[model samples]
Target: MSPLKSYLDLYKHLPQTNCKKCGMAACLAFAAAAMRGQKLLSACPDLAPQVREELARELGQAADPQEELTRAMAPLKARVAAVDLAAKAGQLGCTHNGKRLVLKCLGKDFTVDPDGSLASQCHVNAWLAEPMLNYVSLGQGKDPLGRWKLLRELPGGEDWHRLFGQRCEKPLQKVIDEHRDLMEWVIDIFGAQAVEEEGSAELRVVLWPLPKLPLLIRYWPPEDGMESTLNLCFDATATDNLPIESIYTLGVGLVTMLEKIALTHDT
Candidate 1:
């Protein structure tokens, strides 16, 4: 048992600004990371000097967060088992081949067995599995509207925007900054389609993470005293296809995959 019993214990104390001052995309992310022992409480510059110091003293004593993740996922996994995957496949714009329901994620095939276990030819990343199960079990399965909006603009996205930027957009910007030339190749590998935007984006691409879920990215290289930028946006119907938390997880997972792709090719 740790002094910080749960992430909310610390979340309640913060400014809730979602400011990136702590190097985390959002205040909520920082608190959760701190609870997981991945970050220090003192890392948040916004916290009172005394408060941060006090919390920092208790941070190192936190319990294992892996158990918490497991506890959180258990019910979602159980829900998958109760779902008639084959019967619901069509609604999800996926396929059923008797034994498994096959869903396409970021142009990759991930098959779900009747027991809620997932298998993919590609590695099943920890960030992606939970969301996949969640989508299959509870997603609204609506078709995307093709109209794009920021994570902050989507339903329930206000709370998640900063974290989404931290986990997805900022990392994508980092990749573009370091490996500018290789981006075309990376996007190509993911079958991303080049597109245009009004803001003079040097590169804009669209990708379909799911049949009803589309992601759009726009990048602007450094110029005229402005830093480089990358923005990851989603369809207006994003929440209809996946929950806000799952959407954030999926974005993080995509960024992780992009980093891997860039690394593998740059070498």
Candidate 2:
């Protein structure tokens, strides 16, 4: 069967209530959108994990904006110098995997909605310090980002033995240490400039897919009569399929919004 026909067949199995919650009327509609490379797998709330995984695999095999960015910039983790970043920050553009990108982010600003009505979601940020040294025994497929790394490290490290003389065992101590270390690294990697404003605060964070573009995130209070905006700025050459720091950006952005909300409410 043709690729589009295959996807439509899968969609036929999906619950097609046309809920519109998934941004489409029915599963077939979503499948078409997916074929067109326009919608994300996450958009379908009704999809089970297995289904989602299947779709993601299929999508990865297909052309995508993210893949396009990846080819232009090379994996999201490839580092770029400050001067390059500055030039890209002013103007960045990239294309990969059949996706086109063109934009400029310099001098752009984001303001929070003054009404305090922006839809926010729950988030979690977990980090592991003193990474687990042991290889997790994966029976088959690739192990998930060092899931078993902590098991061996928990017993004793240089510092742990130094303090306890190798006699005591502290449970979950390693876990705590790892998480703290991760958070510290995160903060160091994405430090913000101090800018005080009544209704809005501006911060920038590195997003991988487009090294030339730094995401400008803002928080504003409803009382200030501003709408919150997250701007992804890029030069004309910024690439597609770049890995986004989605978790960190969204999690931290939400916290910043809450802080602003508290400040506004108090006043």
Candidate 3:
């Protein structure tokens, strides 16, 4: 078999579900990341058999995303060992239990041990674990400023805005556009709150995906021959509490959750 020539070549062989199962917003996003060596072909759980065969032929089988997450956790876990969870409890909006810090994550309780290992009743994903680890190890612990800003406006976010939009906002807009009651599900299930921005009546929801990292989502229904649109924003001080990458991870995770809900509704 010939070597993979480009991202499009990689994309053409994907399952094409845009399932977001590999922690990317779309299959194309996964293909792009894989092409860049930031992701693995094995990350997609639904890779077609022929695609997997081609990869094993040329690339000799790659570690899956879970294995990659486990590898990524090592350094972050080591850093947590040096942190005093008790001292950081207040700033990080967590409760310390001598060796572990307990905090609410996506409306559920998650605990971080001294070694940065995470535990919760809810099923954990790398999308959640990476951000939670960064929050514990490197977070500056700044409180939300209430003012909102695009990811591009954040200090390290300019380079990530486009990918963030593609991965988070656009997928969410599609879900909401197709399933209107998904908003009620967000409000009732995830405890998202409806918020009116300034003086406008635009439909918006505020959710705490992490304690100090709140997210704002606004959706505009289709009107006057225009397509429906959605926008996602972070608190002005968002990067103060989590790295820009972590912020992006949090949004991707949120989209994954919404997609699950939408799938459930469909079935």
- For all predicted structures, in order, the TM-scores are 0.74, 0.27, 0.77
Winner of 1 and 3 under lDDT: 3
Question: Model 3 residue 133 lDDT?
Answer: 83
Q: What is the number of backbone collisions in each predicted candidate, taken in the order shown?
A: 0, 31, 0
Q: Candidate 1, clashing residue pairs? A: none
lDDT of 1 by residue, 167-254 (tens): 7899999998888877678566667788876666578888877767888888889989999988988999889878887888888888
* The best candidate in terms of lDDT: 3
**Model 3 alpha-carbon drift over 4 Å, by segment:** 1-65, 197-201
What is the Å distance of residue 192 in model 3 from its true position? 1.8
What is the C-alpha local distance difference test score of candidate 3? 0.81
lDDT of 2 by residue, 8-93 (tens): 66576567766544434456777776666555666566777676666667666323545532332221212221123223222333
Q: Which rank order by TM-score, best down to worst?
A: 3, 1, 2
Model 2 whole-model lDDT (C-alpha atoms): 0.32
